[model samples]
Target: MGKITISQKGSRTIYRVNRRIVCYRDGHKYCVGKPSSGSTNIEFDALSENIAHERCIEICERRIYADMKYQNPVAYNAHKVLNALA
Candidate 1:
């Protein structure tokens, strides 16, 4: 994970993570980070930068977890079972 940053691209103010544009913030309307393949971009109104970043992180984590579960269900289940046992 990388730090979220605010940068200016022409007249647009966008958020980046490790040089990758993740979110676009224009006034009160905030666009969440890039979604996984086949998913549409998420947009919301009236959000602060911190709130947007938090949302972005949450989305990213969900995508990662979903991908992991799909790609390696055995490992994912094992991890979950271990966590439950712990």
Candidate 2:
């Protein structure tokens, strides 16, 4: 049920979810696309590849949670409450 993938794109390594580019590596730096409407991207220079991948996953999950909150506020709050109880 997961749709994430990592692959090389010429000199840069790219991370994607469902074919949409989410993060990338260029030279010695890893870059993750912001989950907002801003035009800026996050870059990590000292992180390992695995860490960068995890960051990408975190950002993607945040975006999904934001969408869920916007589309169904009641369900989102219920889910949050359930998680908090656990």
Question: How good is model 2 by TM-score?
Answer: 0.48
Query: What digit string (tens of lDDT, one per residue) describes model 1 on residues 1-86?
Result: 98777766543466656424545433323454343434433442223334555665566666667888999999989978997999
| TM-score of model number 1 | 0.43
Q: Which stretches of model 2 miss by more than 4 angstroms? A: 1-47
Estimate the lDDT of model 1.
Answer: 0.56
Top-TM-score structure, candidate number: 2
Q: Tens-digit lDDT track for model 2 on 1-86?
A: 55776777454566655324545433233354334434333442223344556765666667778989999999999989999999
Write down the lDDT of every candidate, Cα atoms only.
0.56, 0.58
lDDT of 1 at 1: 93
Question: Each candidate's TM vs. the true structure?
Answer: 0.43, 0.48
